[model samples]
Target: MLKPVAAIAALAMIAACGGSGADESTPPEVTAAPAATPAPVAASTPAPAPVAVAPGEPSPEFASLPAPYNAANYAIGKRTFKLCQSCHLTAEGAGNLVGPNLHGLFGREVGSLPGFAYSDALTNADFIWEPHHLDEWLTNPRAYLPGNRMSFAGVRKPADRDALIAYLMLETGYTSAEGDAPNE
Candidate 1:
């Protein structure tokens, strides 16, 4: 009986030394908790930094677009761009489909990309592809330039057009500040 009581007391002491011995009346001390360790990042993979973008401007990459333009905007813009994807390829070095490959379209001349067949209406048009011009073209392609080869009716909603253009600007590496003068 004496040996069994001593054994029980030793086990009780061990239980108290462990964390599980706290009584119901005593609250756990938060300071006693171990600090959280952050997940380690792989050295080879760097996160994208946000790029500054002004209102009515385009970003070079979707991940780099600043606060007002977030991943949500990219998602919406990406979905909107599906309307144009059937005819265009926004990726770099991608071949032209039914329409021209739209890589680097923002600053290029309307019909200047080589190899792709452009309609006479587009070829004759004298305009560089800036945001405003793109907006107009998207609103009504054939109306913007009669006899253009694009058969699909243009995007009617201004917001939808804006989103699609934003997506295009991202995929094509267009920077809002590309041609801007230095503040200095």
Candidate 2:
């Protein structure tokens, strides 16, 4: 009885100190609390820094465009493109976002990309994409084609429209053929 009471008091002391009452020589039970091991530190690799383009120098992406569209206007277009980035992707194999991926857009028929779901107005329209048509469409999408689904309020400035069209031409891989002239 006295030995059992002594064991109980030892357990009480161990419990107060947040320890198991088992002797140090005794092996811990399978259910015993595990000894804490420090979490392994993850080896972080730094992300590659963005390539900086010099002022007045055209970026490699815009280098192939004609003189006026290649340098200063390309820069403006690139800046303006930020507004469209939320919906569109210009890379050739990139997946569609809110709008369809715009690679090979210049000669493509309106709403003709295979996987994208276009509105009935676009799907039924007979026009191919061209700079002037794009300009009018960007001027006011809703007014240009009533019942179309683009939510942009339209680029009001003609210069901005020009820049944006030139940027899209370069980014979407337009190559000049006989009929593929920029709007004067």
Candidate 3:
């Protein structure tokens, strides 16, 4: 049973990437994994969606984030970040996963994290990570730089990309001052 479930999930991922020769006009639906059973709740009360920080009250870790990035956007970005959690980690001192730990990604040089084995395409590139660069990269990593190891099809929506970038900036310790530096 477990094997069958895994197989179905794998197939779903492939189909989501347009691997099944599905129609191109309609967007594909991708499920990372089978859903787990929810715990029982009282009939009168429904489970509320998880919120990382309450509206109007940002978490201490993200309180310094500037305007246009509020708790609401943070929550959306947190949810969207689920797509990236399997490959990357945002916490400081957390070692690399399939991708590098992204604690200070905003101002860091691309592919320059100390321990991870970056692709030659990235390692040979000369550039720093800024919000705009990250936005383009997340829009389509493969198109942005070929021969990289990441296999994500890329986030297709601009709004999602914005939210994800904002989330990354907040989580990865981006400061307004970093935005002032010219990308090299």
The candidate with the higher TM-score, 1 or 3, is 3
The worst-scoring run of ten residues by lDDT in candidate 3 lies at 63-72
Q: How would you order the candidates by lDDT, starting with the best?
A: 2, 3, 1
Instruction: Pick the winner on lDDT between candidates 1 and 2.
Output: 2
Which candidate model has the greater TM-score, 1 or 2?
2
Residue-by-residue lDDT tens digits, candidate 3, 77-135: 77789999999999999999999998999778999999999999999999888877777
Regions of model 1 farther than 4 Å from truth? 1-72, 177-184
Which candidate leads in lDDT? 2
lDDT of 2 by residue, 1-184 (tens): 8999999999899888978746768776678688899999889978644246664455555556654445436566777888899999999999899898989988889989999999998999888887767878989999998889899998887667767878898778897644455566
lDDT of 3: 0.77
What overall lDDT goes with each candidate model? Answer: 0.73, 0.79, 0.77
lDDT of 1 by residue, 6-53 (tens): 989998888878745558578766666787899998789776764555
Q: Candidate 3 has what TM-score? A: 0.61
Which stretches in model 3 have alpha-carbon errors above 4 Å?
1-72, 178-184
